[model samples]
Target: MSSIVEIKLSADQTEGTKATVAQWLKRKGEHVTINEPIIELETDKVMMEVIAPVSGVLEDIFVREGEPAEENIILGTILETAMSNPSNEQKNDREIRAEETPKNVSNDLPRKNPAAGQPDPPSTFISPAVRRLRQQHQFDLSQITGTGKNNRITTRDVNAYLSGSMDQSAAQNATYDAAAISPTAAGSEIIPHSQMRKIIADHMQHSVQTAPHVTSIFDLDLSAIIKHRKSNKQAFAQQGAKLTFTAYFMAAAIQAIKHQPKINSQFHEHGLEVFKHVNLGFGTALGDEGLIVPVIQQCQNLNLIQIAQELTRLTDKARNNQLTQKEVQGGTFTLSNHGVSGSLVATPIIINQPQSAILGLGKMEKRVVVEEHNGQDMMVIKPMCYVSLTIDHRALDAYQTNDFLSHFKAVIENWQ
Candidate 1:
């Protein structure tokens, strides 16, 4: 008799209420190594993989693809065995079934294997989240190609297809009827909101309702910082850190926070809870999915280079979906660099709950401005960017906000 080890969903998988089985990398009777990833769980925040606890052969899978799996539930079992081979009879049966299944099941549904003219397995091989998106868009799987490992269709691939198709249709029709393009039309889909999207919506709505929001905008001259970067960028690159304007902004923000601790505080019933150490959270956009704020804890202790390195690491992890629960939590202040996407400005960016203020950086551009040079007014070209600070009025006053921004502006302008 083989000893069986249960594979349970770990508590640290996510902070969301539930997670859906995104995919199963291993099948029943397949041999798996200890600590090897066997399954992926899609939570409201991110997609995480579950690893096998002990070396064994996968014996049973209780959670199928696209099914809701609660935390600590046994997802599957692994039998103590090293055998990798499947039974000859089972293989023959699988082959026969593959041959018998239709290549395309329905025009509205995705095809199993359009190129091979064979139907996909009965399971559809798509996560519930991706399947919901496909249905909502009324997409035919045969039309879109999968880019994931082993040609699995990912949510990103489906989003790209939708974007391209919409653009093409709009161009062809010029003034397309809005009703005709609605997903509720015939052959269209109405997808229920995913858990992650719902949570985000609720949080945002609660934030707007809870705080008395106020925004103050300022135009920043980046001449000194730009010149500094041009001079030392090569040196910074040699030290494995790419010198970017964000680092300068981060450093300036830290200095401002130090000067005004109230900017890094939260309002409570008892009193104001001001934090001594700045836990800076930077927003990273994940296309089609949503945004995530990964924090660099104790940011006040890090220098410019260290801040840059930490930001790079967190950003890379966020984009690659490798951030842990801890990395996304406990932020004292938030920054959204919306300028990266070419936006000019975004006012009154909602404060991340419990955090008093949020900063938004707009696009940087060169413009001609009149300046007093050598006791005379002179016109010169300079790089300028707009920075907006949105604060919870209850926790921060306009005077404090202005003071913080003044300090921040001075730091950048007088960068050594």
Candidate 2:
């Protein structure tokens, strides 16, 4: 008698909620040992490979590639059946016959099989973002070549291919006679949105429809902070860190929120609901598709080093399709660092639902300005950045919104 060992999903170290099965390494009837990598789970935080717990033959897979799975859910089963006993199993006759066939028997088989003796080579032909986009748009990718690392197709290539194909198809359709063209399009496609994308669209539409958004701008002088960062960035990198301006802004925003708690609040049916903890969500740009705001919880309590580490980890996970549902959830406030992309300023960023305001930081630039120092007016060069805070006017007045930005500016100017 053979016992079955189930392979279950596990959550990441952070407060992440769900993961998607990125890829599977082994097929049914393949023998695997304990701790062997069987599947890769793309959580909101990182891509984690779920290893086998006990040696057995992989029997059943409960999930497919690109499917969103909940945390702690069962992914597959490892049966205690021996590799030699291929005839006695639950698989259908076709599956059994296919399994019995030699690896080189497949019609699509190349002359030399690179995956014959070694473990399955990674399917690096398409990047994750591109694959997700293709799946979303129902675009067939038999003709596109990936330009990413290792010849992997990127999201941009897929998008461009889609656009070009659509234009060509539309032109070809117009040349056809009305009698030839069916009343209902024959080759049209109907693609469904992913769970993550649907949620994002719903929230974005709600925020735009419900909130009377207002944006207030302020300029900050970062001469002092720039010098401080220039001096400390080398030391920070020595500690295994990428010392971007985000860490500094996050620290400053925490101080500002502590001074004015009303900005870090939500609007409910009753009235304004203010939060005590400063849970800041960083609006990370994921390639060319869209943005995802992965939260950094308890910003007030964490030190600079800790903030940098978490930011690096979460952002990397977000880019690499590793974020969990929890990592993308529960944000009290949000920071949109549009400055990194060379934009000078942006106004009225759509609010993340349950949060009342979002802060936008524009590009940092050096400009000449006259200032009175010790009763003398002198032209001086200063690094300046524009900060725009978009608020829900239904819950907040303009005065309160402006005051919040003012406090934030003061924090940056007086950074230690």
Candidate 3:
């Protein structure tokens, strides 16, 4: 006799918090293999996939798209049965379509299921705005590529496809005219907050409200580090790792933390919780989608090259929306390197909570400075950047904060 099994969101998958139903990977009655992903759950920090517990047919869905789901929530059910092989005709059709599809199309785009002999249903996760746009343009969801989390379609993706299909000059003219129109004259848009955005907003507000923030800024001379990287960057690149300034900064931070262990600590109700190891979290901006911090655990033990490799891997995963939950959690210290986008400095960068302090690195620029050379003052151009440490005043005093920055500056300035 066939048995039905409940498919629930694993408690450990989301750290016991609520998540939004991002998408359903399989439709009802769809055959699924053991451990195959059946649904996606979008939490504040990362997108998590809920996989099937056993090989079976997806029998029913208990949760709808975009709805809040608690930990261990029964999202669906599966009817246990032996997997069936696809017919030759269905398999041939899928292969033909795969060959015909453009190379530029996302591999995650929904296609005909070989076993079912039918195109996968459009995700019920489509936003109202996207649905309206799709209907207005008479475009099928499968025809447009999704660039959002988990390859979910966004309104911008549809608009880009439509713009590409139009004449170049006409598209440019339309974009110009749209920008020229004021929101008051042409109806302002009211976009509902995305789940991720809402969570970020709440978290930021809570952090600001909870902590008495104090910021200390220092300027660092990066001449030695810059020269060192310039000399060895090519050698590092040949080994498949791109040596970046952030890596050097991360290494410097680790060294600084080693000198002052209190910097790599968190605030607790009874007392300060000084961590023995550094779980470094670096901020990665995702444009309008806001930022994510993917942590490099036990960073205290990693060398410069290893730090660079981890930074590159995490940044790539962040941009590609491929980061996991654990990759973003358990951070004891946070760093925000906003300089890459050309911002000179940002003071009082809010601390990522529980962590007592957060570091911010600003733009690196060449500046003329007077320095003693052979007992004579000489003017020379040096690479300089601004760094800030925003600390929770309740947990850290100016002495500890300033000492941390001093150690960090010393490490950067004197790098060999």
Best by lDDT: 3
Error of 2 at 387 (Å): 0.5
Q: Looking at candidate 2, what is the lDDT of residue 353?
A: 69
After superposing candidate 2, which stretches have Cα over 4 Å from the reference?
A: 1-90, 93-201
Q: What TM-score does candidate 2 get on C-alpha atoms?
A: 0.60
Can you give the TM-score per candidate against the true fold? 0.65, 0.60, 0.74
Q: How do these models rank on lDDT, best leading?
A: 3, 1, 2
RMSD of each: 9.1, 9.2, 6.9
Q: On residues 17-72, what C-alpha lDDT tens digit does candidate 2 reach at each position?
A: 35667667566766666776677555433344577877778888899888866666
lDDT of 1 by residue, 146-251 (tens): 5443345556556656766777654323222244455767787544554456657766888889998999999899999999989988888777787888888998
Best by TM-score: 3
- Supply the global lDDT for candidate 2: 0.70
The segments of candidate 1 whose C-alpha lies over 4 angstroms from its true place after superposition are 1-41, 49-196, 373-376
lDDT (Cα, tens digit) per residue for candidate 3, span 333-355: 99999899998888645636778
For candidate 1, what is the total of clashing residue pairs?
1
